[model samples]
Target: MLTLYMEVSLTETQQCCGDVEMLFRRWSVLGLVIPTLLIGACSSTPEKEEISEQPAAELYLESKQRMNTGNYRSAIAHLEALLSRYPFGPHADQVQLDLIYGYYAVSDNAAARAAADRFIRLNPTHKDIDYALYMRGLMSEDEDSNFFQSMFNIDRSDRDPAMVRQAFGDFERLIREYPASKYAPDAARRMIALKNRLARYEVRVAEYYYQREAYVASIGRGKYVVQYMSDTPSVERALELMVESYDKLDMPEAKQDTLAVLKLNYPDNSMVN
Candidate 1:
């Protein structure tokens, strides 16, 4: 009986020793992590600049003030300082957001998207995620500072299509994943506008094919509108164009098909009788 009791005590001692080793390992991991995070948080910049004891939040605001004054380069300097010194600061998100805006104001779209993307990734659930997403759309559209281009550049050059698609995806994800988000309703509204614009683009391409008398090609585009662009305002116009193309091609069967679809869709039919 004594021997059995001694064996149990030895087992208990072994278990205690294992626990102590595990605890030591955990604490060592924590120690390494804390310092690494601290070092990673540091931002690189000119070493001669003064870092006031005032809060980084205050410095971030000061940077924004520089942006408002049209000192975009100066604003970037301040924002970078905030990024490096206080990566984990309360105002980090706000500072990054300002940096994106400032970069855009300076006509640096690539840099703007990068900064905006960084903020969006870091603060996916921030209250201003909607704003960030919207900014991305506007940035992609080059709608911020190229206002002078409006006079002579109605030809948008497909410059923003891919970016617009990306922005649309981001907003859609935000709405789908965060239905309760304050940004959802507004995002849904903006999504409708984006859809209309994209649909119009589809119509233009279809019209190009139609103008070229490429009946088959035009039919492909028209069907795209009917199938994928039903919600688009240009849908009826697309259907009408399809019917016209079919008639021009002497494809009576296809013409009837197009007319039937148009009638079924737009029974009130002011554009077609």
Candidate 2:
């Protein structure tokens, strides 16, 4: 009986040892995998840190190269990243300016305008303030025009002139404040174009009133163009409309006065002839 008990005890000891060996093998596999995963995770962290710690000068150069290649979208990404990483770095101001142009290139006019405004507000005396003002004016110009209006040579004179007026005001302010700036000449030219557009818009309204036989309203619109948009090409048409409206209203003296002015200004005009 004692010998039989010892055999049973030895068998139980052998089974317990087998179970411990299997558990040790599983733990060994897990230990190898956990270290491998930890090493991989540790290795990846430095790589990300290296990428995020790219120097601002290098990033700016990369962005410039992208922009030179007309890859403005990629340039924008790099610029944005650089700005995010180094907000008060040496390239902060220039980065803001580049971002404005980048947004403009992508036709994100609202973003461009907002960037410009922020730059102006932050750096009111910046050397590139004139450039920002000019860009702001340009972004505001024709902002409401649709793709079809741009694709086809449709007349925008009859459309809403709110944006056009805002653009004109922007250009005017730029010229008024920084008359000697390099961009001032271009701004002045754009202002002239805007004035002509506004004059044309007023003339169209006058024509509409005339077509509806609203002679007094037509005369008022035409007179406004003559007074406020004197040098514009539409002034000639406005004067003619005024003369015609006055005649329709049976105001002989006013008709003769407007006719005389139109003839003096546009002698070869068909209406004057």
Candidate 3:
């Protein structure tokens, strides 16, 4: 009887040990899974909270506040978030316009120009369409004068005139399409300045060609300024260049006629004397 009882006790002890081992295994698996589950929960919660925290109107107002404080970088972040969240919201148009200005303030001229163009394209009849056009023109003008040039006050007259010409066209369109717009006066003023810049660029090209002894090319450039860019400050220099180029080409009649026009336009010009 004693031997049988001892054997049963040993079997019971073994069973208890097996149960504990199984429980430990279960806990081990749970230990790995719980941390992973917790990590996932923690990671996803913040993003959900962030998205839910600021709705469209709040984001728009926040962006405006940042803009008011001259915190354009922050304003841009808010504006972008607002746009992404509420593309068809009530403040979409104003948000786009603000984004353009924010990009411009930070000297992100490419982004600013793109925003302006997109706004103009999407909202052709928007009440503030003229504002977009004007901003686009300003952005195009800024493209020609980069940070380095602006900081050092470098002359951009000798640079490529493509952007300048684009800016001029933008301003011209604004003034023509919205003559009564509040922004029209400013756009007109910018157009005049851009015209002068284009004329100066043409004169610079004429000077370059003349210096290189490309008399025919110089004459063409000069004549273009005289005909297309009349009344600009560069016209005087263009006329002078044309007279010189005509003389270089041994076109005496052309030279005489150009000289006569130059004298009539600029009597006190050094070339006239």
By summed lDDT, which 10 consecutive residues of candidate 1 come out lowest? 1-10
Per-residue alpha-carbon lDDT of model 3 for 36-131, expressed as tens digits?
Answer: 433442322222113345777778777776666555556678888888988999888888888887776655677888898899889999888887
**Of the candidates shown, which would achieve the greatest TM-score relative to the real structure?**
3
Residues 1-273, candidate 1: write the lDDT tens digits: 000001001122222223233233333433343334433433323244564655776776677566555555566778788888898887776777777766665456688788878878888778766666656765665442234345556544334356556666766876877778666776678778777767777778878888898878887888887898798888988888888898888999988877888888898886456
- Stretch of 10 with least lDDT, candidate 3: 1-10
Name the regions of candidate 3 deviating beyond 4 angstroms: 1-52, 146-154
Model 2, C-alpha of 68: deviation from truth (Å): 2.1
Screening candidate 2 with a backbone cut-off below 3 angstroms (N, C-alpha, C), the clashing residue pairs are none
lDDT of each: 0.65, 0.75, 0.74
Worst 10 residues of 2 by lDDT: 1-10
Native-to-model Cα distance after best TM-score fit, residue 118 in candidate 2, in Å: 1.3
TM-score of 3: 0.76
